[model samples]
Target: MSVHHSVSTHHHGGSGAGWLALFLVLSLLLLGLVVAIATAIGDYAIGLDTVFLAVTNGLGLTGADISPIEQSVVWDLRLSRALVAALSGAGLAICGAILQALLRNPLAEPFVLGVSAGASTGAVCVIVLGIGGGGLSLSMGAFTGAFSAFALVAILSNGATSGPNHTILAGVAAAQLFNALTSYIVTTSGNAQQARDVMFWLLGSFGGVRWPDFHLLIIVVVLGLGVCLYMARALDAFTFGDEDAAALGVPVARIRLVLFALTAMITATIVSMVGAIGFVGLVVPHAARYVVGPMHLRLLPASAAIGAVFMVLADIASRVIVSQQTVPIGVVTALVGVPFFALILYRSRPQT
Candidate 1:
């Protein structure tokens, strides 16, 4: 009976692994399709074939048949934006999944930890005061701000002593303080144009993303995913509670501190590149959980894939939603996220 039970458990695990592999492949294909479509359907529409050719030529896999202008539009502009969108989305979603698992809270996300607000404050300082020096300065400032906020939260949370509640409270305090700082900077020091730019950034826009941003984002997202996956077992143990995790030989306090800091870094990197694009981290994990169940190993990859697809589609929508005017990516995410948030709330209520 013992042998039979072991065999059955192994068989079940194999089947689950197979299903997850299939789901991941399908999600990746969907993401590719979205990227292709996004590249082909902008204002100056490049055909799908042309986009492919441009990509191949850029890779030196084929000779260029497309015009220089079309090549530039496809390879230089749209592809960079799509890649950034996908990377940022994947990073944010993974952060959300980790935070939720770490905190054991369904509502936990990257922003709940005050990283975005801190980033915004840092960016505001750069833009309003001209501290950093150039375009890259804003990103540098935001990164600094994000880390600073996380540091404050860690200190106030007392290194996971009381519980996630303490961490959440610390995050809330940090967010409010940073947000006020951002507002004060914008109101007091920023010129009209700077204010307008800062507002657009606060709302999030992918319009200005370039290859440099894409390169940095891809590196960060890949590293973050690797770190999260390595800690997947710890995250799974956390689902049972801190006591259970400690019993399982996981250093509950240390692990929590590490995961929170890692997530904060990933969130800050993405926020610095694209501004504080909300809701991807908050909503994508829940959607992925519904599709893939609650195992962190499966949940993390599923969330990342879904998030990448969602953000690319959102970017396309932001571009085409209005004639000749781009909507902020944050606004697009909010419009989609609010309905999901409502649904989550509705479902969470006790059914009589």
Candidate 2:
């Protein structure tokens, strides 16, 4: 009887894994379809043939040069912005996954734990302080703020020494403190115009991205994602708690430092460029978990992919929501994310 039950359980697990792989492959195919459709829907619509021509030419395939308007639209404007959205989405989602594992909190999201607040602070510091950040000033400000917040939290929590408790508490405190700092800066600013711009950033947007940012976006997203993928198995060990993981000889403390630092850098990199788009990190990971179970190896990549799709779709919505007027992508995500979050919280409630 025991042997029969064990065999049955193995079959169940194997079947579940197979389903997850199928779901992931289907999701990837869907994303490709969305991208193909998206390139056709923006303002000044281009036909699929023209889009293909532009794409082939822009990619430097053996093709005739595109007309100037198509070339400018496809290569100079749309593709770069789309790429930026996708990369930022993927980065934020990856950061959320690691933070969730480290803290062991399903509610652990990048913005909620004060990462966005920190990055917002850094960005405002540069823009408001007249720091002469040159072309890359925005991202630099965001990265600096994000790293500072992580450092402060690390010092307070002692990084897994007090385990999850101190880390979460510190995150809460740092987030509030930094948000207050941002508000104070805006209120105290003598420059009214600068104050308004900073206020807009607090809300987040993809409108700021342009052709010039693509290189930086690609570099950070690729490097940060590669490193995170390398560390996924270790992050999985963390899900079982530091003690059990340590018993398994997983170098718990060392892994904590490496992951925390790497996640922060990735979050900062995205925040610096994309201006703190929310919900991708927080909501998308849970959505992926629902589809793929809680295994970090599968969860991290799936979250990144879902996140990319979510942001791309959100950006499209932002563009079309107001025909003559444009809404920010951040607003669209928040509108959708807050309610979904409430549902999660309500369902997660323990019944007496």
The number of the candidate with the highest TM-score is 1
Give me the runs in candidate 2 sitting further than 4 Å from their true place: 1-21, 133-136
TM-scores of the models, in the order given: 0.95, 0.89
lDDT of 1 by residue, 107-216 (tens): 88999989999999999898888875676588899999999999989888886776877788899999999999999999999899999999999989888889999888
RMSD of 1: 2.9
Q: Native-vs-model 2 lDDT? A: 0.77
Total clashing pairs for each candidate: 0, 1
Which residue pairs in candidate 2 collide? 139-272
lDDT scores of the candidates, listed in order: 0.89, 0.77
Candidate 2, residues 1-352: lDDT per residue as tens digits? 4322432333336676687688778878877666655676677887767776777888888477668898778667777777787777888888888888888898787765567789999898888875654665778778889988988888888765777867888988999999899888878863889987876677666766786777877787778778777877667767768876776568888878887787778777777777777777888888888878776667877888888888888877888899965676789989989998898898889998
Q: lDDT: which candidate is best?
A: 1
**RMSD to the hidden true structure, all candidates:** 2.9, 3.5
